[model samples]
Target: MSKVRWKPGNLIYPLPAALVSCRSKTHGDNLITIAWTGTICTNPPMCYISIRPDRYSYDIINESKEFVINLTTTQMARGTDWCGVKSGRDYDKFKECGFTKGEAEVVDVPLVNESPLAIECKVVEIKELGSHHMFIANVVSATVDDKYLDDTGAFNLNQSDLICYSHREYRKLGQKIGHFGYAVKKLKKKPRRKKIN
Candidate 1:
């Protein structure tokens, strides 16, 4: 096999494709498609989203200190891509993309009701890094569609059909290969054989 080295750039693929909703008093509501977002901490439930300062949502989120992260699905690929390219200053992305906005539990920012999963976040801190600023937010509340719940009251996120963004393309997630500790965790031990004679 042959390999070639490439320049240092964004090589990480398969990031969650999310429509981040933020609002301002003047602009009312807006949505920005984001791929640079992920969970930073689990204990206090923290996450971070990186965005350029010039983006429309940047100012809104900075001023309001809150936003909703709406998980995207395969069905929303087109809308997600469109929102990323189009600026909120020119158009009402939520209305144009046929997405419904519902009141967020923690913040005034509206959540995308069309999304199967919506996470309401409150900005805890901000870090300015070169081109993009990172908004470190503590997840305030989350709302998921009841239909995604299993009979045992377990949330089945996979059934919601999540989507991912790689480079500049949108892709749907595939089947689950294994659980958290499937590789190392021991399975049920077989019953020991009874003593012979």
Candidate 2:
């Protein structure tokens, strides 16, 4: 098959649309919907979120050095898009979006109570990358909504109807075909019973 080529740019799609909440003494709490966010490490538990320096939430996060990453769901699609479009300078996102501010355990910032998962992060470093500044942080704490927990106490995140950002569009997570290692795992064969003549 032939393919057409385009100029180099960020082609990665279907990224997690997280609402990052930040607060400081000078500035009140604010939520910024971030699509440029992901886990950087697993051992020490680290993540990063890239935001435009001009964003109101950027200063609050820089001053506080902490933020909570709240996972978005299909129910929060409107609020997520709204928060990203509107500036915190004019609107109180939490109140406007009808979201409750739930206190985080390790960070001073509050999390979105409606979210199924909230990850509290403390900034360790900041990289000014042209258009956006990447905040590299260590995960201080992570809280999950009990409603998303299965009977075995395992997190059923897929059932949460999580939403993602793809090419400026918000989409819900689709069907799950397999687990982490299913592709490489061997299938067990059933033992055949001897026929009695």
Candidate 3:
């Protein structure tokens, strides 16, 4: 195999397409579809979302310092793309997208009711990283839909029909290949059958 050289850029494929909701004193409620989002830390439960300064929700989140990261699904693919393209400056995203505003436990910002999971976050720091500014936030609370909970009380996120963004297209998640550490996990051995003598 041979490799081709190209311009330096972010070419990481297949990122979770998240719908981030926020509000401010002047802006009211708004939703912004973000592909550039991820978990940053585990202990304190932190995450980040990078947004361009010109985006309508950028000011809303920057001033409010709070938002909810709602995981998207295949059902929400069209709306997610719409929210990203349309600006809250003219359109009421929640109303336009028909997204229900679910009340967050700790933060005043609202989560998307249709979402299987919602993570409430408070901005801890902001870094001006060129074209997009990164908002580092601490996850204050999270709400999971009871429908996705298995009988064993484990969250079955795989069953939610979630979608992700790759290149320039949105695609539904495929089959579960394996879990973490499965490469080194020992498989259980079956018991030997008793001798029939």
Please list the C-alpha lDDT of all candidates, in the order they appear. Answer: 0.91, 0.95, 0.95
lDDT of 3: 0.95
lDDT of 3 by residue, 52-132 (tens): 999999999999999999999998889999999999999998999899999999998999999999999999999999999
Report the C-alpha lDDT of model 1 over 6-114, residue by residue, as the tens digit: 9998889989999999988866799999999999999999999999999999999998898999998888889988999999989999889998889888888888887
Per-model TM against the reference? 0.94, 0.98, 0.98
lDDT of 3 at 177: 95
* Candidate 3 ranges with C-alpha deviation above 4 Å: none
**Which 10 successive residues of model 3 have the least lDDT summed?**
93-102
Q: What is candidate 2's lDDT per residue for 1-197, written digit by digit as tens?
A: 99999999998998999999999988898999999999999989999999999999999999999999999999999999999999999999999999999988999999899999999999999999999999999999999999988889999888999999999899999999899999999999899999999
